[model samples]
Target: MLKKIGFVGLGTVGKHMAENLAKSDYALTVWDEDAEAAAALGKLGVKVGSSAKETAKGQDLVIVIVPESEQIVFGAEGVLEGIDPGTIFVDMGTHCPETIERMSKEAVKRRAMFLEAPVWGSKEHAANGLLTILAGGDEALLGRCREPFSYFGLNIIHIGKVGDATRMKMIVNMLQAELLVSLSEGLVMGNKMGFTPDKILEVLDSGGVASPLFHSKGRSIARGDFSRNLALKYVHSQLERVLEAAQKFGLELPAAETARKLYAQADADGRGEEDFSAIIKLLRR
Candidate 1:
């Protein structure tokens, strides 16, 4: 059991994940780009560190959740540069799969264990300790980390080697974007056809198409509450990556592309910080 754990990145998801780990009695040493974010976690009894190296020093495990792959490995005081030789470093951010592989190889060369462990679900799910985790690394290592992951995740799956979890996370997020796009179009089209969103949701709830994703955000849409939960800017970036990868494989994804365009439009309209369901505003207009 890795006892002293260090965390880098304190975004919406990372904050809650660290809080869960802290609540589980892990001796947490943490750092974040935002000093106030670190202070907030420090108030929770976590040791707030000034830099990633300080966070990593002597910790059995180091976890990173930065926005990009490069930062995960080579940012100012990144996890790779700071983690101890024998410590396990888990990359939980959604990032490029190739980057995951390259970083893992480099970490191994430095005698550190590296694992890709991207999570699925929003900040709410993270706060509730219900996110689903997809992990890729040595199977034995993944098994060793499962108990801690279980404290904050509903399920944890060991997919394959180093880059596999990033790929899996992309696929998962792409499907989520697709569903959001389709549901947004359906709701707007229903409203245009003289049916209230509530009526359409009533039908959807009774139909085979109903799901928690739809029920949760659909209710938000029906209630006209489009505040940020998952931002459109993040979704747009992930869709761009998905498209680039799909193009490399010679696949045409019209629906995904359409969804990508809607996100881009929403970004242009300054709704990038708004929930993904806010894409309906463009359609409804």
Candidate 2:
């Protein structure tokens, strides 16, 4: 039944996912480097573990959704320390395929089952329990976890196995980075040509290129609200992963490379914590 669950990492979307889990019937335990983040979950009856290891200890399932893979595994006081054999581990973060493969190997070494289900959605979707889960691992394991997963995921898709979900997530976010940059340039260009941002959005919405992303982020940028939904730095990191993978496959992604540089420049200017739509500020400059 995968009844008992331990969750590590309480960043942006992770916090919301854990919150949904705590609200569910599963016995949930959570931990994070930030005491305050873990404390919030405690209010909802989630047991706050002292560390990642402490959380994973004795739990049937352990989910790690941190920004980096290594820190939660082989890092100091990491989750691997607490993981018992037969525990099913799921990582729902965007990371390089190489890193995901390494984590899978480490999980196998510990005699635990592994799944990489990097989540795809904004903070709003996570908050509303509508995040899409791109899962990659054993099909039987996914079926075992479906009940708990349904508590937070709107769509639970099995992409393939091991590093597969990570690869998909890279492409998803690479296109996201490109799309946002393109939208930003359009808004900036249209605004400079004396069209209101709203008008530009209205026109785009009336056309074939219109999408949900365009509507939501376009309005947010129009309102000048760059509040962090998905951190720009993370998107930038995903682009790096995409480029790294591309380099290995000998694929030249000109658009992704150019978009990564824009995100990099924005990150350097101290806008890393802002929403990805906030890259328009860099484009505006």
Worst 10 residues of 2 by lDDT: 67-76
Best by lDDT: 2
lDDT of 2 by residue, 90-150 (tens): 9888777777888889889999999999999998998899999999999999998888888
Clash count of each predicted structure: 0, 0
Model 1 clash pairs are none
- Predicted candidate 1 versus true structure: per-residue lDDT over 1-285, tens digit per residue: 778899998887889999898887778898998999999999999899878767877888888887884654576666667777999888888888777877788788879888889988888899999999999989999887887787779988889988888888888878999999889989888877999888888899998999999999999998999877778888899999999999999999998898888888889999988888888888878
Model 1 residue runs over 4 Å out of place are 69-72
User: TM-score for each prediction?
Assistant: 0.96, 0.97
